[model samples]
Target chain A: MEKMLAEKPVNVNEEGYLLEFAQWDKDIANAIAVEEKVELRDDHWKAIEWIQSEFKKDSPLSIRGIKNSGALNIKEFYELFPGGPLKKASKIAGIPKPKSCI
Target chain B: MKNLIILGAGTSGTMMANHLVSKLPKQEWNITIVDQYKTHYYQPGFLFLPFDIYKEQDVKKEGKKFIPKGVNYIQKKIEKILPKENKVQLENETIPYDLLIVATGSKIAPQETEGMNGPNWHKNIFDFYTYEGSLALRNKLRDWKGGKLVIHITEMPIKCPVAPLEFAFLADTYFRKKGMRDKVDITYVTPLSGAFTKPKATAALHYLLEEKGIKEVIDFNIDRVDYENNKIIDYADTEVEYDLLVTTPTNMGDDLIKRSEMGDQLNFIPTNKATLQSLENENIFVIGDASNIPASKAGSVAHFEAEILTENIQNYIKGKELKEEFDGHANCFIETGNGKALLIDFNYEQEPVQGSFPFAAIGPLSLLKESKLNHMGKLAFRWIYWNMLIKGIPIPFVTAKMTKKGKQITI
Candidate 1:
């Protein structure tokens, strides 16, 4: 129910995960993060940036990827974004919801 | 022709029906499966229903669809099992069997816990084990703002032991997505001192709880549900309050088992864990959640037990020694939320260890480690459950027995 700054209508799935990757921006990420109760600390930005870049390169983003990406380890990634680190981080980073999430 | 009657056309019953029809000569054996309900629910899917990960259609199918053509599928309420006479009494009929398979799986009994069925039930208190309970909890969660979301287990030996933890993890993700993570206070209350029964897995899962910021209330043996006050009081007088209580109530075997006086205190048939043969009666074999085995009451355990039981049943019919022995083998995927899950495979003797599964050092799925591939594997299981498992078709790599080939014993 939170508003995003997208000029075109931003479409999301039933769970509020963005359906379109092109509609994502830092503003949208901030808005989503705020709704998620995340303050977007440096470590959080590092993970978000890594996932976004991985998406652009067409590489699969995973827990192992985040661990090996040197951006964050498994423990830190979970601390930065508790519960669902990869799914939540990916959503904020503007990627399609991963198929494995369900 | 001799009759081999199986009670409850659920997971084990359906699988036994499919497995036996092919092995037992139709000229000499008549296979019949009886249950009270016409629909068979994929019980594992109930864990996802509360999170909206699985819909009703995904988990439900006609019970008769999976039963083979040669077998007789009866839909009737079982009155009692006269094991001494080798007969099962239905409401209107008394069916005789040369051999009987007690697959009348367990059920969640909220009434066993005082005050659990009070006014708050289905309003503020809910369970996700049954179809109706899951559906009700799903609707309640959709518009639920934020409050104390407590996940409690009334006791152990419940079906799918890891489901409560999975529910808590999913709830955390659900609330985070709804932008109310901060508004919600999540707590996990269990009878065990840690997240799981196994120590190694507990250490790993305990870290997951801390990482998620979910508080743990361990060693809380629930004595009663103070429903009006929205509190659960343990035997030690310890109380935990909650706005929404999602609990796994006390699980027990079917009421018929209790009436027959053929089961343990919990109504679970006392069976030889290795042989699957009833300790009380030789003609009766207990499988799945019906047996009082130390193993987890899970579908995978049932599948494994069925393999051994099928062979034992054949041996019994042939007047040969029952040679097959079941080793409490069970494997399950623990959904950790955020598109990742963990896999654990073990048996009665061995606990889950950190290693690759099915292949050594080159696993597409990692054991005791969270990965997206495991999550994908878990999701794909829904398809397998419908198509292959119930049909008695063997999965490519996994077998009935637990293997240490790919597992790391040193931990």
Candidate 2:
């Protein structure tokens, strides 16, 4: 669905992840971050940047991937984003949430 | 005759051997399959094994019984695969291959988590992903005065993803049958956001958790097992205490992938998801849980992949363009206790929705809804698995690629 983010129409899914990465921008991210109750700081952006880069490469994101990325340890990752870090950070970075075949 | 070697005589490797043995011209290709073990385990039976729903004899048979007469079967440890050399290193012999199929599947690595395989291993802490683990759990449950029964998943990409949930369901049934339903506190814990990976499934099946009184602990990225305290501590410092901990530990591709330096961080080989051809080399193909495909690591997925892979291998041999036809198709029966189960039919593009299967509005087997017929199908599957599935026989009405005929995708 198209919704106004940073005063611009951005397409997102029901869960608020961006449908197209092209529609993602810094202002839009900050807007979504506000909705997710996450304040975008340097530490948060580091993880978000790493996540978006991985998504662009079509690499499936997982907690395991984050642990191995060398950008941050898992403990600091949880602290940076709080609660469900991977899903929250991916939303802030405008990538699809990680999923497994059920 | 050129040699076509298959590593691992498990489901995928054995099916490949059966598939190509008749298709590959006898005068042109010699097929040989290798595995260190003699037993071909009915892996799905591991779920029922703990509840004593299945016996050891029912789940295992001689691996040789399944391999066709023409193919050579070697029971020996595989040392490594020298992929660049197009050769495989066995314990004492190095065999060159015109084509190599890697089916060395995934297994549980309890040691991947600290304190998982520590002092209390197999005593109270258990895994049912293996025959040993299942049998050990069976013995443990035989006399187990139930406490907090924690059914956990240490990480994702584990084989038979639904088995853990089924374990929770069956545990409820088992305890009820034993007249000790209240004696056990069943908790389903996962690293995923909910009881299921897909949103629709989570929505469709959330009632099972509520109906059976199974507590859920989601988004739990476990850091270590506090074995001394009988607690699993996550990165967030959240702890879930358990008396009887049934955990599926970190599942990884075989260490041979690591030794050969041919796999990703999880040791799964990178492969073309559609063609089943290894991305790194054209002559190499991977199937089953060994490849890092975004599909459930289950026998059903392997069965579907075997059909597409057989065609692809023949295409590669015939110098034809490979068909990008594998659509990440996976069909599985989710046992939801009380002589009922749910059947889910899905592919890369389709989420399992409410409908009939293999026929539109005429399903003897309903999709995404719990039914007793589906439960019967689950029981009858053991026979099909042993008699037909591993023999490369096409299951009636099931296709290599999923069909959208009977599905209600509008939801």
Candidate 3:
């Protein structure tokens, strides 16, 4: 495997999900989203913002939680991140991977 | 007392044993469940093994543990089923039955595809249907540095139809996390015209595939697997090359069904789709993947069919009309990776629609929509399968019949 060196190194799990929530920032989140091939729109930013806040509060992050948070509806949430909405949204939001994501 | 023999001590067979043990009169009938193996595998857990979401021990349990107290559990390979004589031929002896339940579920036949079982069988070509196959694939993925990964389904009627789609989605997430998403060229190949069997779900899934940057090759009937060339050839002579192939090979009923000459061309016993009764034999009933029904060949279908079949079996014993009719009620949680999943509930007449499930307006779970709750539901199902389902304990609110109460019909 080729060495993955970043200017601002981030600790991630074997599957690449974020391990430490405190280490996340806008630059790292943007980089992750770019790798996921998702162009972050305004709504995407809202999802990321909500997820990060929820993580800070130690609240459960879910599709329903996102929808209930008024950040995105079910269709809009799926449209914003496509496949694996919670996983991708969490990654881009710079939060630890959800327990159910495995 | 008369013998009521059940073939295959798998999911359906075990469930039937638990159900009939309490319902049937022990004085008039003796319940017996037969199989060749002693381990009962939670088959759905196989889908998560390749991704390391589930471990080997999580999906396996002692088969005898689930067999009810009053029922006789026999561990023997069935040689053949003599339906005419109302007897089953085992390796050493023959056992006669007044009533028989065929629950010998389907098996993946990799050899049916040319070159599939060749030198690259477990090396580059792997199937996640079996326990060993899933483990091998997991080991292979650990060192795989991302190349052309193709997930293909050879034919339809495979157990858990949405599993391949789940694999594709999970692989995308897996590679992305491995920091090699750009290096891997992921593709999903299927015999169907769309990503799934149903129409509405197909459209939604197609969009998800495009969003994930995973190429989808549909309606491509695979004719052969070119192992040396590392390519899969379709009947139309189209070639799809792959560095690694995760395939769901042609799934067929047990070999005993074929030897007995009581099954269709695919070794599935022909049965009344509504009644679950064998078409050629009155005393025989086929459940799970062993039946040639229009419904999806899935565990949920079998779970629903068992409820109806149990009632019908009781009715048969009492010389009463078999009034229970199964409407092919099936529900599945489609795992879309990254900790989110979608729930779908439908029957023979209605396709999956976007709506709340079990209730019309108040749904803790959404239908046809991906959610974290659905993912939790999928994960929690493992516990339910082991405890409630096989024990014949009725799940509250979720009945065998499909209801339109919470479903919105969409054209």
Best by TM-score: 2
lDDT of 2 by residue, B1-411 (tens): 899999999999999999999899999999999999999999999999999999999999999999998999988899899988999999999999999999999999999899999999998999999999999999999988889999999887789888999999999999999999999999988887778757677778888899999999988889999999999988888899999999999999999999999998889999888999998988999999999988889999999999999999999999999999999899999899999999998887787888998799999899989999999999999999999999998899999999989898873
> TM-score of each candidate?
0.80, 0.97, 0.80
Give lDDT per model, in order: 0.84, 0.91, 0.83
Sequence-dependent TM-score of model 3: 0.80
Model 3 docking category: incorrect
**Model 3: pairs clashing at backbone N, Cα or C within 3 Å:** A101-B339
Could you tell me the TM-score of candidate 1?
Answer: 0.80
Which candidate leads the pack in DockQ?
Answer: 2
Report the lDDT tens digits of candidate 3 across residue range B82-192. 988999999999999999999999999998888998999989999999999999999999889878999998875677878888999999888888899999999999765
Rank candidates, lDDT, best first: 2, 1, 3
Q: Comparing to the true complex, what docking class would candidate 2 get?
A: medium
Error of 1 at B221 (Å): 0.7
Worst 10 residues of 2 chain B by lDDT: B196-205
Fraction of the true interface contacts (Cα pairs closer than 8 Å across chains) found in each model: 0.00, 0.41, 0.00
